[model samples]
Target: MGTGNTNWKKDFDKAVALHKKAINGDKQAAQKAYETLKNIKFQVNNHSLVEAYFGSSSALIARDSTDLTDKTNYAKRGMKALDQAIKLDGNNVEIRMLRGNVAYRLPEVYFKRTKTAIEDFQYLIKAFEGNNRDISKEQYYEILLKLGASYKTVGNSQRAEETWNKLLSLNNSKYKTLVEKAKSTGGE
Candidate 1:
């Protein structure tokens, strides 16, 4: 979260790397990514995605939060930023992906965000049909995976099976084992 770097993309990518680290249990990385993304949001011309990352960074912070009130507040703040990002650019691939994934991770009973995750994943799937160039194969795979899980979460096992089945044709050798596991385990 250094201010020495003037380039927004570099700062954003660094924060993204920190986010990845945070996901792998590096708790301090989450706070750094949050601050970095927040500052980079003001540095960029495209506010939607930067805002989306800012929001996702907040969710990452929420994951590491120990206090109940802080957790809820950060999660809510992140959701609001995500909603604003989507409103700014509903079809944006990155924004939808971030928001949807974050929503999916939050507790459904408390936040009731699974439905929102479903909607965003559904949008991402449809968007992929129009242009695969914008959505990487990994993203496409993740979208299908999460979409299927979201379907199952809402009690629609049939669609979940259908979605998981789609991953087999992905043809990516790197995820071969993971794909099989997702299909076999109902995306659990």
Candidate 2:
């Protein structure tokens, strides 16, 4: 096999071992493994490793369960690491999707203070620019759903509705599900 396949197998094996160790309560080993995987240079797609980083960051945030104030910083660090992954391989759909997810989960108050959440969401929009039309459509609807959800969380009901409508226009499977969900919930 070529280097691409070889490196991916190595990363996959390490990721599995790390997750097993984490499940067995080896927190330090788990963290070290996740960091190593995140830093691994792979010719194959590295989206899974990047997502593993997000999972580890989320785990770290959860460990500090008492500190809501610090959770935002945890999210910020995850965003930076995800951004680095995106810089390395910007075309990976999963990386862009995970970046969108990080933006969507951020608290509204913190987002208002620094606007980082909005910037992150905008980055998702930019990530799809100039892709093939079919892929573009799929990503466009995903962004609309995420943006609509974020705006609703932030109390921008009007913008959320607009985004929902744009998503409905695509008539894709997921967007259709979302449109019906919105209608049932009175357009949130």
Candidate 3:
């Protein structure tokens, strides 16, 4: 447990550093934090905490990366971290949500691992189902949108169309056209 605590402290320090860097307009700090967090894969049994850190660090890194190629690689690393966090804490809605989020952002052509994304979305939906009143429809809809996009990217036109229709049923008109277009274009 001493090592676990040490890892936690390290993560906390990195978070503090990231905040300081962002406050000082250090764009690279965020990216650095992501790499640092990735390296800290300290095997936390507490899934929620691990996932929370993973999501926060990944977001910072992904948001800071200027090059598309770099962003994709960083995002992929973030996804792996989040996935492991989820395995340790599969019951956390937030963890599953982060997984869906990372999966959604991965490149379609090169990182066309739609199956992984689909599993994450499935987990998110299952977790969400048990917490409907506690979670906002907007948040759930966002996952659905990303899941649909993932399906489209993997050439599952039917699943994408069905998911898009489900989103529309939830009154998410904002992404309806885009989803429909993707469905029609067979995800390009």
Best by lDDT: 1
Candidate 1 local lDDT, residue 84:
86
lDDT of model number 1 = 0.83
Structure candidate 1, residue pairs in collision: none
Q: What does the lDDT come to for candidate 2? A: 0.59
Note the residue pairs that clash in candidate 3.
none
State in Å the error of residue 95, model 1.
Answer: 0.9
In candidate 1, where is summed lDDT lowest over 10 consecutive residues?
Answer: 1-10
Q: Count clashing residue pairs per candidate.
A: 0, 0, 0
Expressed as tens digits, the lDDT of each residue in 1-188 for candidate 2 is: 12445555666567657655754667665566556555553444445444545444444443444576566665666666666666766566555555556555555555541233345555666666655333466667767776777766666779878878877876677678887776566433
- Tens digits of lDDT, candidate 1, 1-188: 32344688887889989988987889899999999988886666447877888888899889889999999999999999999899889978888889999999998879989889999988888888888578886788878878887887777889887887786677766556775676577555
Task: Summarize candidate 3's per-residue lDDT along 48-90 as a digit string, tens digits.
Answer: 5455565656655665778887777666666666767767777
TM-scores of the candidates in the order shown: 0.79, 0.53, 0.68
Off by over 4 Å in 2: 1-9, 12-73, 83-94, 110-129, 133-140, 172-177, 180-188
The lDDT values for all models are 0.83, 0.59, 0.66
| Ranking 1 against 3 by TM-score, winner | 1
